[model samples]
Target: MAMQDLDPSEFKTQAPDAHGQVSTLKELGDEMKAKLARLGLMIAEEAGAGTYLQRDQTTSLCSTRSKGVEVLPIRQALQRYDWLKDYSWVAVKADTDKFTRDAASAPPDVVQGYFVRGLKGQVERAPVQTCLYVESRSTKQVVHNIVIAEEGSEINIITGCLAHGGIGRAMHEGISEFYVKKGAKVTFTMIHEWQEQMEVRPRTAIVLDEGAAFINNYIALKPVGSIQSNPIAYLNGDNSRVMFQTILYGKGSSRMDLGSRAVLKGRNTSAEMVSRIITRDKADVVARGLIVGDAPGAKGHLECRGLLLSDTSRIDSIPELDAKNPDVNITHEAAVGKISPDEINYLMARGATEDEATSMIINGFLSFDLSELPPEIAKETKKLVDQTMKGL
Candidate 1:
């Protein structure tokens, strides 16, 4: 169904036993844990600093293993800390869209989502893992997440979203807000694994303080009915920096519109937006990036690359740069093309079969540099990418 035809009120808001409690990921059934593992969750050992899980419209797990950070359900956090009101719904307005309105209008008792905070002067050694799973068919899961890194602190997070493999159809809407305080750093990696009939929409906004840094990595390599996401970051403090990297594989008849924006409002601040997309079958993909420099000494760049693997598939790369100040430096570049015959022929001449050469090229095309991610998360991300490439 088209987005305009979707009625957010038609889906059930509650599922039976969805609020059941679990102290650890191992408490979950083997089948469920295996599914989560494919989506980048560390289920075998407690290797992460924290873990949060939301099943359907309720929280099933929320725990933190480190004293430097705190992880709790959104509702509990809101009730425990009055200062949270200043940050909640501030980065992203609650009335911005219908999905946001749906999540905002939920009753207090049924509210679902996670709240994560990193204390001042502390650095978490492992990444915090979170998951939003849709277990009931035709269910609409709407959640709001907040993440904060206090001054001089550092943290890494890995989040995954997916639907049950057996589910015929479902919908997911998520709103996320992030705050990086002065001299703090935050690394966020998100992986999406959805069924063929799932529709996903995510709204996100981030703000940075003086000397703060934010690195974002996104990976989506599965069949889905449709997905539309555009996350924006604002560098409001002097010397703050932000970088966004996205990797996508679109197959079947899936439709995807993914983009990122950065507003450089502080002197000496910088931003980067990079994307790599591959499409096959009858898939339609649009990759977009924008950088706006509003400060005198601001610098920014935007890049997008696309590869078409099937004759019927389509890819559109749009890269834009806006310099509002005379002294600012901004640039952008975009390219969309298919595998070159010369490169394939050169590989074949090196004693590789045609099929083997093509596979090698495709694998290299989709590979990403995971050096920025935490060691454990980097390992999981590499495994996930290898598994996704096997189907191609």
Candidate 2:
């Protein structure tokens, strides 16, 4: 598939505010509700502790039900608390790239993203759910998100990015920065489902303090025109830890480039990066991972696996590990291959059709041992994976 250069000025930056039209998710049309559910947004009590929903350039909902956590619009949060200036653009520079520059320079009328903060020593029982949807054609959505987990606090977040089917062409640029203070833990899970003609670019960076832990899970299953994302994490304090898991499915003539990098700069710090990619039809995919150990007693690992379902599809895997200290340990493993006929035939002999057998094998291949995730979020992630496999 041929790619075109992105021109920010060509897309509309303003749209009508639909926030007052719907008071709750249940009030939306049934079709729209179902679409949101597929991206891990629900109306149940356990859905999340807070909810933030944005449609085009308008914020439909932003509220926090939990006592210890605070959720507000980014612009409002910045105005309410002057201390936020110290954290903003600290983890991720505003001028890092073209996308970041554009997002940082967005007009004041555009709806900025949401702000989430976990107070010191407070733990939220449920994750915070946020959804960013593009409903207008030829629109440009620029969002800057910030997440802060105070010392000894823990918070989980689930973000969904989707594009309306009626919209013909659109672009999304998201900038996110996360801070995990000493002894704190933060988990973020993101699901992306967009139209085949949509383009997406997300820039994210994380900073971890002493004894902090961060886990990130990302999934993109639906067909899309183009997507490029590479998020980096810095373990700057002693005993800090970080883990990343990404799942990507490429279909039609889409192009996807996704990767993650981690730098272990603290003593005894550890990092891990894992990716699973599957391409069908004439799609193209590139999976990349990098881990650097810069302190003594630090450890890191990188793993990437790719599967090809069609002859015209393409998959590329790149894994790199670097150790600057003699006492550090770093390693990487990567493999790319197609389904073996013998394995498929074995499944077919057990009273299963060809398609069924193939699905079974793919399911088994995508199976993950993620004991770190909360039970509810884990179940939702599994459901999304199963639905995607069935669709394929």
Highest TM-score against the true fold, candidate: 1
Q: Lowest summed-lDDT stretch of 10 residues in model 1? A: 1-10
lDDT of 2 by residue, 244-314 (tens): 99888899988998899999999999998888888999989988888889999899888888889999999
Candidate 2, which ten residues in sequence have the lowest lDDT sum? 14-23
| Clash-forming residue pairs, model 2 | none
- Model 1, 1-392: lDDT tens digits are 55445566777667535668787777887767887888779632477889999988778888888877888888899999999989999998999888778878877666678898999999986888899988887888888899999999888999989787787778888889999999999999999888888878788999999999999999999888888888989999999999998999999999888899999998999998888899999889888888999998999988888889999999988788888999999998888899889989999999899998988888888777677778888888888888888878
- Per-residue lDDT for 165 in model 2? 82
**Candidate 2 overall Cα lDDT vs. reference?**
0.85
Q: All candidates' lDDT scores?
A: 0.86, 0.85
